[model samples]
Target: MGKKLFIPGPIDVRKEVLEKMSTPMIGHRGGDASTLQKSISEKLQKLFYTDSTILLSTSSGTGLMEGSIRCSTLKKAAIFSSGAFGDRWYKMAIANNVPADLFKVEDGKAIDIEMVEKVLSTGEYDVITITHNETSTGVRNPIEEIGDIIKKYDDIIYCVDAVSSAGGIKIEVDKIGIDICVTSVQKALGLPPGMSICTFSQRAIERAKQISHRGIYFDLLAMYEYILKKDYQYPSTPSLSHMFALDFQLDEILKEGLDNRFKRHEDMANLVRDWSRKHFEIFTDENHLSNTLTVIKNTKGINVSNLNKKLQERGYQIANGYGDLKEKTFRISHMGDYTLDDINELLDNIEDILGLLNKVY
Candidate 1:
């Protein structure tokens, strides 16, 4: 039996989603391509809750993250990070020669409004990036509160990395005043990886036009103009496989009903939270736990590697701690097509292993 993935991403793709990737190839510049891409763009606009034009990339979500900040920022950037992925945004900025500063809260803590306001009010910064969900520490930043905070400063561009939380959680892009919002296919979208999709606003377009050296390939303005001219076709060749699956998987997601899907994720998260509380403690604060995954503190200090080995034999797999949190924490994902029954079964198996280890040999 294939081991079920409870990892943050490249999460267990549904059988139908997997098959969509095998769809026969198509011409990227042909009329058929326009029809396919245009259809996907329209659906994505509804998914993102915005009227802004959709921008699709042939790379991971990181590509858009790099492009958005580099292309649109006229001055320095203040990147607010709560965990590892959040830290990456700051690193991406510096690597691209963008003047940037990272303001981070302690691990396992969410970024607060006070820190955000302090940084933005400095008057030295013109752009800001917030990781909506930081997978490393299992913290989902309060984007609604943060978005409200950002809107107060009209000149500061608001960008969000919703990579792990977008489809699993509800994010209203236009209502939140997010100028650029990015996400990929693998996580809660229940599809295979390879491409990323983001929303681009008119204000962001104007900023990109002012920035001259925005690098090749990731140049946001070049992409937006091409799509506007070609009617949703990307400048370079696109990933038809990922796009095909995305179109189909989105249909499945919408058919399931957005509210129902969010509720399913909530119910599964609650089940894991209850289980984690019973056996191990949750790593992040209760107020900001992620709806898609739970990072459990190794309260008992068991050998996590051995535990995973046993889990594999039971036909399931979860993620070990990331970065500096290694061995100190373990993550169990309840995202994608996974159900409540799957969570219960996985927990029962974990209970059996914990019981055996507790027994005196």
Candidate 2:
């Protein structure tokens, strides 16, 4: 019943995007569906800044995360973690019987590039998973710089989880040499959950061809082969509604101007960071804070759950800390279609609920 969503995902969908989702569904394999899929793919290629093929998944971003690790990993994978989502990728790897070793940094910090270099130097891994933005810790890894290092090994595939940063921030997929870049509709894309998008390089497709155990539902090789025959449509019934919304949403995003959108997110993130510094400590590394979300350390010892309950009563929502960090911190997301005015209102509400009118910035 809230007018806004300040949580990490399923952010406030614009009225236009919501309306597009309501358009009448067409047969998934028909001309209409192919047109919709082809259009979205082309637009997404622009968003990703790559000429590589874009793949659509009816499931969430995690589905493609799993698929990327499953399909592209030939010998082994080096899973890098900055927070919970990165850890989830490793979990998916083990669950699918994909051999992988996890590398994680301390909480609130990103994995060092030197560490990544050291690990990759061992030549034990053919695939690597990196999170562009860790929503849990509010840390944005330096993927471009890291990608430069990873690219030298042509045989190695680098898969990036950009679920929370793709549209809100600029990710030059080709420049970064990302073999597989995965994202979803709910976060920075400013659409509802249910649809996911990924850009896959030809190198990744070739690797998938060598792997016999890549699951059917998420087989990148199958997706590649089927789309070659059809007009960029999926093997199964695609979510036409999500595609409709995405087609429209991508237009709005491009019109808004990618640089301007990135600037807006950066501006809002700076505002929140300044506010957090004056009030409480930021959970993530200051140098690598995420543009889409801010995690504030609960230094003031306020009851975050109670505060959120009060916030809900006021028709607003914010996320409490995640995993082991719960109650120690709270997150406020700046992604989606939200503006600075929206964030100011949310902060005002939080200040009022905490009785920190004087304490809060």
Candidate 3:
């Protein structure tokens, strides 16, 4: 049996969406490709709530996240981390030899607005990176509130990793003054992994001009320039297959209505949260719980791998805790096209396996 995916990313893509990937190949630099890219960009504007330039990269979301820092920051980057993914951004800065500092909140807790403001007040940082939703910890930071503080400093570039949240959650990228917002197709877009997208503001373009290295492959400025010059084409050969799938997926997403889609994700997440509290504890705080995934603490100290084995037998697959949290917690994703009834079935199976139906926790 093909197990259903309830993991953080590469979530269950609909059969129709997958079919789009089988679309006939097109010339990356041809007019046909331009039309496809343009269609996807316009739809993405609707998704991101931004009038800024939308740039598509034929790489994972990490590609754009790295470019955001390397290309846009002329001074130092202040990276605020909530969990493993957040920490990865900080590591990227160091590995690239970018002048950066990393600060983190209490494990699994969201970054508070006040905490962000305290760091920004120093004026020592030229850009700040925030993870809108951290998959590893199942914590959703208050990017809206953080944006309010960041607005006070016009020069600081605000980069957000919305990799796990974007299409699944409503984030008004422009309203929040996010200079660069990154998200991948594999997460909430209900598409296979490969292509990633981001909104690139004019401010970021100008900032990129000031930075020297700004690596070539993932250069944000290069991407923005190419899109403008070629009229919705990328500097390098693009992922035409993913573009075909993305264009189709965007149409489906719009038809469903963005608000309704977000609510659906929320409803699924809430069900998982309630189920977790009834048996295992939620790894993150209630106020900061992610609407896309729930990480449940192993309060019962069950063997996570064994549980996954049982789940696989029943044709469902979930995620183990990431990094150090492995075995300490287990995650159930509620993102993409997953519905409430789908969540119910998964939970029913989990309860039965854990014997929780008879108070097995």
Candidate 4:
């Protein structure tokens, strides 16, 4: 039996979207490919709510996050991290030899706005990276509130890692004044991995021009120049398969209506929240839960690994807690094409597997 994915990314792709991936191959540099690329860019602009140029990388969203931070920071960067993924971003900067400082909040806490203001007010940093959704802890940082704080610093480039939240939630990139809004296909876009998409505002482009040592493969300026000079095509070979799937999936997302889609995610999140409260404790700050996934503390101390093994045998999958919380917490992702009915079924199965149907009730 095919196990249903209740874990975060590479979420279950609809049959039609998967079929789109089997589309006939096209030359990456061909005119028809350029036209298709152009259309995807235009649609992405609408999706990002920005007139800025959008770039597609044949890598995961982490590639763009690395590219944006490396290319846009002429000076130092202050990376605000909430959990594991945020820590990874800080490490990416260091590995690239980019000068950066990381400020990490406690695992379950949201980044305090005051710390952001205090750090940015120093005017020592040229860029700041914020992860909008931290999958490990289920914390969605207050990017809007943080945006309001960072907007006052005109010289500082605002980069956001919205890899998990982009399509499932409304980001309003331009209105939020996010210079580089980064996302990937697998998470909320309901497509397979191997493609990362990001919006590069004119402001971010301008900043890249001044920064030195921007790496070759994922350079923001190189991508922008290639698209402009080569008719919306990328510098290296592009993934036509992923693009075809993304192009079709973006349409599905639009037809679902952005607001309605967000509402659906919120409703699913609420269902998970209520379930977690009844069964286990929510690990993250109660006020800043992620719409994409919920991290539940194992208050009952059930054998999570064993339980997951049983779950797998029954044709369902979920994520154990990340890092140190692996046995203490577990994650349930509500993103990508899952509905309330799906959530109920998964919870019911979990209840049955844990033999808690009667005890919890």
Candidate 5:
């Protein structure tokens, strides 16, 4: 059997979902494909709690991230970053020559709301980007609170990268006034990596219309218009395999119930968080801890690589900390279809390998 995954993403897809990926392919422009796309869009709208147009790209979540900022940022952008992925938005802006500035906080901390307010009050930015969940630091930003601040600026387009939290956490997209929210199926959506999806607001489309030179392949306005013009068909040939699996998995998600799914993720997160506090220390801010994954401080100074090797022997695997945090911390993902029982089993294995079975909390 494959090692049960506890890493952040491409998190163990359900066998049924994997099977759907292999179903016979459909013609890209056929009516069957349009039906599939339409069904997926409707289900995603429910998942996202928004009536905004849903766009699909046969690329990773970063593809839409790049598109959203590039297409909508007419003036300068205020990129508020709390971790690595947040930093990436700023990089995408510069690479696309979108003219932007980056506002960052210390690692393991959520973006400061007051800092965002101070920057937006400057009236220098027409667009703003926030990362709802930062896996590198295990900090889930208070997007709802930040959204309230953004609501005060009517002209500023609000975009969020909910890559790791969209399916697992409760984000009321419309209620929060987010114009563009991006996520991939590989993470909480419980499918293999290939395609990404997002909700594009009318406000964003209007903003995109004001900008020129929005790149062709990843252009949000073009994609949205193409779908409306061609009956939910995309501008380019799409990934039918991923689309097949996503349609089936989204139904499964709805069958399980959104509230139940969110609660399961929270329960699994709490299980791992409590375990981390007892065995080591939680790396990110306690108040802003991620509901999808927990990053643990390596206070014990154990060899993470060796620990993972031992876990592989026992048929389980978890992630080490990302980037510079590697070895200084470790991560335990409870997103996707993993249950509390699964979290317990992985923790039990870690305790056995570390000889902490009899140790008192």
Candidate 6:
């Protein structure tokens, strides 16, 4: 059996969901494909808590991140960063030649709401992007509170990268005043990697129309118009395999009930957080700990790679720290289809491997 995955992305996929990926191919331009896309969109809209149009991409969440910044930023974008992924958004802006500025906080800290207010108060930006969850440091920004700050600026288009937290945490997109919210199937959605999804608001569409040079393939306005004109079909051929699995998995997710699924994630996260506190130390601020993953500081100076090796031998695997935090910190994901029982099993294995079974808290 494959080692149980506890990483951020590419988390363990359900057996039933994997089977759906092989449900035969369909003509990408046909009615069946349109119907499938339409179905997925509707379910996603419910998941996202928004009335905005849903857009699908065959690329990872980064594709739509680059697209959103490129297409919506008519003047300049105020990109906020609390960790690695947030820094990636700024890089996307630079790569796309979109005028932008990065507002960053120290690692493991949450973005100060007042800093965002200060940036927007300058009236130097027409767009803003926030990473709702930073898996790198296990920090979950208070976007709802940030949304309140952004709502005061009607002209500022707010975009959020919910790549790691969407399905696991509750995000009321419309109520939060987010014009663009991006996520992928690989994280908390309990599906394999390859496809990305986003909510595209009319305000974002209007902003895209104002920008003349929105890049081709990832252009939001173009994709939005094509879907409407073509009756829910994309301009490019999509991954029919991922669509099949996503369509089936989304149903399972809805059937499980949104509230119940969210509670499961919260329960798992709490379990891990408590374990981390008892053993090592949580890397991120306690006030903004992620509901999907926990980044634990290597306070004991234990060999993380060796621990993971031992874990793999025991049919379980967790993630080492990301980027510069590697070895200094490690992560344990509680997202996707993982339950409280699953978390207990993984922690039990870690304790055995690290010989922490009787270590006093």
- Evaluate model 3: give its TM-score: 0.98
Clash count list over all predictions? 0, 0, 0, 0, 0, 0
lDDT of 1 by residue, 155-200 (tens): 8888999999888889899999899999988898888788888899
Locate the minimum summed-lDDT window of 10 residues in model 3: 352-361
- Give the alpha carbon lDDT tens digit for every residue of 83-199 in model 5: 999999999999999999999999999999999999999999999999999999999999999999999989999999999999999989999999999999999999999999999
Clashing pairs in 3: none
True-structure RMSD, every candidate: 1.6, 1.3, 1.0, 1.1, 1.1, 1.0
- lDDT tens per residue, model 3, 1-361: 4468999988888999999999998888889988999999999999999999999899999888988889877789999999989998898898889999998987789997787889899989999999999998999999999888988888999999999999999999999899899999999889999999999898888888888988888988888888889988888988899999999999999999999999999898889998999898999988999999999999999999999999998899999999899999999999999889999999999888989878745
Please give the CA lDDT of all the candidate structures: 0.89, 0.90, 0.91, 0.91, 0.94, 0.94
TM-score (all chains, Cα) for each model: 0.97, 0.98, 0.98, 0.98, 0.99, 0.99
Candidate 2 lDDT over residue span 254-326, tens digit each: 9999899999998888888888887789988888989999999999988899988888888888999989889
Ranking by lDDT: 5, 6, 3, 4, 2, 1
TM-score of 4: 0.98
How well is each residue in 1-361 modelled by candidate 4, as lDDT tens digits? 4578888887888889999999999888989899889989988888889998999999999899999989987779999999999898899889998889999999989999999999998989989999999998999999999999888988888999999998888899989899999999998888889999989988899999888778788998999999999999988998999999999988899999888889999999999999899888999999899999999999998888998899888888899999899989999999988899989989999999887777653
Candidate 6 lands at a TM-score of: 0.99
True-structure Cα RMSD, model 6: 1.0
Candidate 4: global Cα-lDDT?
0.91
User: Weakest 10 consecutive residues, lDDT, candidate 2?
Assistant: 352-361
